[model samples]
Target: MAEHPAYPVGLRLTGRRVVVLGGGQVAQRRLPALVAAGADVVLVSPEATPSVEAMADAGEITWARRPYQDGDLADAWYALIATSDPDANARASAEAERHRVWCVRSDDADAATAWTPATGHSEGVTVAVLTTSARGRDPRHTAAIRDAVVEGLRDGTLVAPHHRTRTPGVALVGGGPGDPDLITVRGRRLLAEADVVIADRLGPRDLLAELPPHVEVIDAAKIPYGRYMAQEAINNALIEHAKQGKSVVRLKGGDPFVFGRGMEEVQALAEAGIPCTVVPGISSSISVPGAAGIPVTHRGVAHEFTVVSGHVAPDDERSLVDWPSLARLTGTLVILMGVDKIGRIAETLIAHGRSPDTPVALVQEGTTAAQRRVDATLATVAETVRAEDVKPPAVIVVGAVVTVGPATAG
Candidate 1:
């Protein structure tokens, strides 16, 4: 006789007990989705990955610091058996079966009562896929299908329009490191729904170009507020558009609060009684350096990393940065908006006791197709930058961490 088909249903596991019988990679991967669904998860294993341990430390999940016992799943609404030891997995599955709780076994799906589906989430929707006809077959096919569905949803090809009940508001979104693909799924979805986009020069311009023709795209740099009133004008634009019942998106480059003046806009909106939401992006400070294969913080290399704005010259009266203190650090120094003043900045660091030979890397147009790197040291960076004609919007990395990454140079 043929076996009964496995039922496919979304479990409302919020505030409900769930038992995870492993702490390795498979369990690590499944725990996040369960935690995200508000499951009261208890992970059982003598050891766990650093990520799982971190989650336990953060109170996101409970960790039983020992191997699974027979009654581990007695109160669990669901159980996932993911231990590497087949014997342990079998014992956990057997206990779950006795308790009448459905079990998903990572080691052997045919020997399990449940199968975990390939899942993808976009906007407010979650998609889960499981192939019944090819049960216990290769998971790659299902994962591929999931990716295709997600791509369609992101690009507006798979639209499931929902009625908006809330009043129009502003979203301070960070477009990561000028790469269109680097923007978060939430950020991209919000961008597609925006009626008006007030964009900065450093944001992902390609994504802006893809906006629907009916949407209004304002150039923030060209805001007609003169030089001094530019910020005020942008704030007014966001408030005015939102008051008109239009969804306004103040899209900026990198994480909104990382030298992006996002809070200023949020404050302006709050005083105007406009609702505001912030969706942070991947900041270029760390992402740009990583793109160049430079880890900002490497074990035993850079214990600490500081990010500072180099827009103002070190000796300028308006500068608030303590160059002397920065020069004393043994960690990495990442400076943004410092290209124009890099020459002066480099000289200041060297003068403040930083080694004349400290490794420095200038990543221009980082994380993009036009990305280029120029290497130098404290004593020679200014000359090297000038010679390379490095422009603004480049990240300046200083310290041993630069040499520690794959793109290390003199």
Candidate 2:
């Protein structure tokens, strides 16, 4: 990841009055980084934390202990805000834009023209994790990710391909876990184009808000974890709507192929002679483990991965799987809908000679904005989940590699 020579590097904020218009932990966290980079950081807020005041008292940073002024951005080459107030952050972003200054709006990364990477330092070895949403992209998510990365400095791990696509038509978009914004660009684009939006109830309401107002939002919205319409009814509706020349968006919570019946719908669409596309959204199967800070694949931990569905009734022959082989495979195993059948599934594996204490990560709402992860050994996962009341739409990852989640997840 080299930069072009013409590209600007970090600004020379050293000794320059770089204004920070907030006083919370974000400011506290950024202050040390700014100082380490030699920026003369001036915190301007009505209040601050104990650490902030401590820094200001020891000549570590300067403070403007009053309300923000009209021209707070004067002589500021760089600025940042963490006011926890949307309107204030908006004003700060607008002012920075007007001043033609390099700014990092912590609250709204999308509004800023530039950003800071998630950097980690260990005994003079510093590593920074950056993303495509680095500059003027989804900054809020990036910033939060950056912060999490920094907090996990001691646990610096290499990155892997999450596998994203930006094609047109419906991707059976897997909105990761509960976070609507986690949906891929391709998935979002299809939603915008959908004339008829047929979604499962598990799909978040805020995510659906991205659709055009006139789009017909049909809630064939199945909640497998909860209860709703029959599967045949939902599949038929997809064909019926697509046949009408309407761009049908069959929205699934996580990647459609992962227990979401995305393949069935695509097959049905093909049979109906409707042009269909499958956008591979982030499946909660793997992503849930990730959301819980567990990696489905890790060096020496797990080498291969298999995604399976336990939601399908065992009466269906296709639902029957080679549990014995799976138990023998030296790889990570992610099971969707295996939560309800945790006992039977685990028993099958154990009977097939798999270890009883294999690490299992149970993630609810996998990658969504609001996620919950429960780490337990294979021997106790079923009981742990029941005790936690962990619901469906959750992912159960099994193997040695999954142990990394709780330690790695923020």
Best by TM-score: 1
Count of clashes in candidate 1? 0
What value does the lDDT take at residue 222 in candidate 1? Answer: 96
lDDT of each: 0.90, 0.71
155-262 in candidate 1: lDDT tens per residue?
Answer: 665666667665699999999998899998888888888899999999999998788888999999999959899999999999999999998998899999999999
Model 2 lDDT tens row, 236-299 = 7777776665667777777777667778878876776667777677666666676577778888
State, as a TM-score between 0 and 1, how close model 1 is to the true structure. 0.83
- The clash numbers for all candidates, in the given order, read 0, 11
For each candidate in turn, the TM-score is: 0.83, 0.54
Please list the residue runs of candidate 2 whose C-alpha ends up more than 4 Å from where it truly belongs after superposition. Answer: 1-174, 222-229, 312-318, 405-410
The 10-residue segment of model 2 with minimum total lDDT is 153-162
Model 2 vs truth, CA RMSD? 16.6
